[model samples]
Target: MSATSFAIETRGVTRVFDSRKGFLFREVSRTEALKGVDLAVEQGAIFGLLGPNGAGKTTLTKILSTLLLPTGGRAFVLGHDVVTDAEWLRPRIGLVLGGERGLYNRISGRENLRYFADLYGLPTAERERRIEEILERVDLSSAADRRVEEYSRGMKQKLHLARGILHRPQVLFLDEPTIGLDPKSARETRKLVRSLVADGVTIFLTTHYMFEAEELCPQLAILSKGRIVARDTVARLRQLVGGDRTLEAEAYGFEDSEVSALRRLPGVSKIIEEEYGPRTRLTLRVRTDEIRPDDVRALLPDHPELEVKERRTSLEDVYLDLVEEEAH
Candidate 1:
């Protein structure tokens, strides 16, 4: 697609931060937060950006939202240059970073939306109507009159969403929008995101949750160390694992010797263990073309009962493989 066809575009964009130390805080070194990153987000598409912590997701979002200037290259939102045309661009896009701290604790949710609407220059009558509409859409109408401080984390997150879309922006940037919400709340938020995209709002979402990205975004990019390591549809990304099968087993009272024994299996290439109180979850990677569940079972010393299942490749597997390869 042409550059103008995208709602958000960046070319060789870079951001650098000066690290300082000592009492005077003299500049000691420069760290490259974004290293010539390039991206194109199609209009009305939900594009997911996945990365580990400090991978420059927030930095890129800030530059696109015009909250921070890129040190090199260029970015355009809705065809408006992010740096030079920020005044014209701000009203066309909205940003919702994770956390409830952005809302005013002393004010009602309705009031907070009203304040942002006013900033967007929505007339009195239009502001009231928009506020009501957003509150209903985000399912926060019941809590509109209550002070924000009295609301729960999920409620606060919904309010943040309502505030972001209060002006009906053409593009929206969501940075870990469901970070601290419960499962139900996260599902609700994802539904809202889909509804917004259906209404023609372009969504640029940053998340660490692979399943969430796979469910919401048709296309995604994996960023590692300020650069994109992989970008494609979730299905294509999963193909990076290329025929590798995953064997998952759950058991109680797993000894370290058993884990070591499992690692020695013929086809087992990698083992990841997660402990859930008294139970242990083991995910084993079988590198062969065909998955041999018997191989995994053969290594298990008959002790506590174990439940095992086999599955195809997943986005998490692809992401881990790419990031690990990049590190090497």
Candidate 2:
């Protein structure tokens, strides 16, 4: 894609940390967080970086948001180079890192946002107006005056998000945004994200939650073993396994022993076991991506009491495919 079409771009970007000092409390050796990587995210799109822990998602987000520099290669946000034009790029992007130290604990949430607003140099009148708007958007209006130190983890996360958006940036980077939130709070955050995207803001999200990415982002890239294994819309990625493959099952007395048998079956790629309201359910990814009920049924004969159900391919399939490829 042309440079202008990309809200964020990176080419062969790499970052390494040297810890040769030997850590009794010190250091040890150089750790490579990101290997050669290339990416281009379109403007106004929620582009997800799907991966498990330590898979370079945060490193990529840090480089794009100007928190960390690449050890080699190039990275840019909104046409501005990360290293040389971080200042120019900074205001155009908002970052909501799912961690501590993003806000001032001594002050109220409103006070915290106002401080950041001033840092961005918003005028007196506009800063207050924007702060009020963001507080409402993040559902922190009721808690706006409470000291951040007293806020719950979810509240802190919301404040971090609010501070990032107060400047009304063109691109927003959210790294594990729902990391520590409760179910209700996480749902609220998802709603807030949808509202922001509807307002024309581009979001770059790094998350391990397959369902979250599946629900929120149409386009995504999976990072595994320090490289991007795949990049595509959720529907397109699901097509990798084909349309004829689905987990067809008959449920009666499903047991833990059934998982192993199911995995050994032809066309079954992965299996996830869960209990729902006292009923045991197994989620499986078929080797083929198509909807072939008979083949799936043919693979299971012992469980006549089993129920026939077809589970659709999701972001988890894409993630598992990447992980599986790495193992081979």
C-alpha lDDT (0 to 100) for residue 111 of candidate 1 = 93
Distance from true location, Cα of 106 in model 1, Å: 0.7
Model 1 poorest ten-residue lDDT run:
235-244
Per-residue lDDT of model 2, residues 1-328, tens digit only: 2244578888999889886674476756778888899989888889999987888999899988999989998987887788888888888889999666678898899988888898898899898888988898889999999889999999999999998889999999999999878989999999988888998999999988899999999899999867888888888787664332456464654655556766776666666565667556666767654435655455566766666677666567667866777757
Model 2 score (lDDT): 0.81
In order, candidate lDDTs are 0.87, 0.81
Looking at model 1, how many pairs of residues clash? 0
With candidate 1 superimposed using the best TM-score fit, by how many Å does residue 221's alpha carbon deviate from the native? 0.7
TM-score of model 2 (CA atoms): 0.83
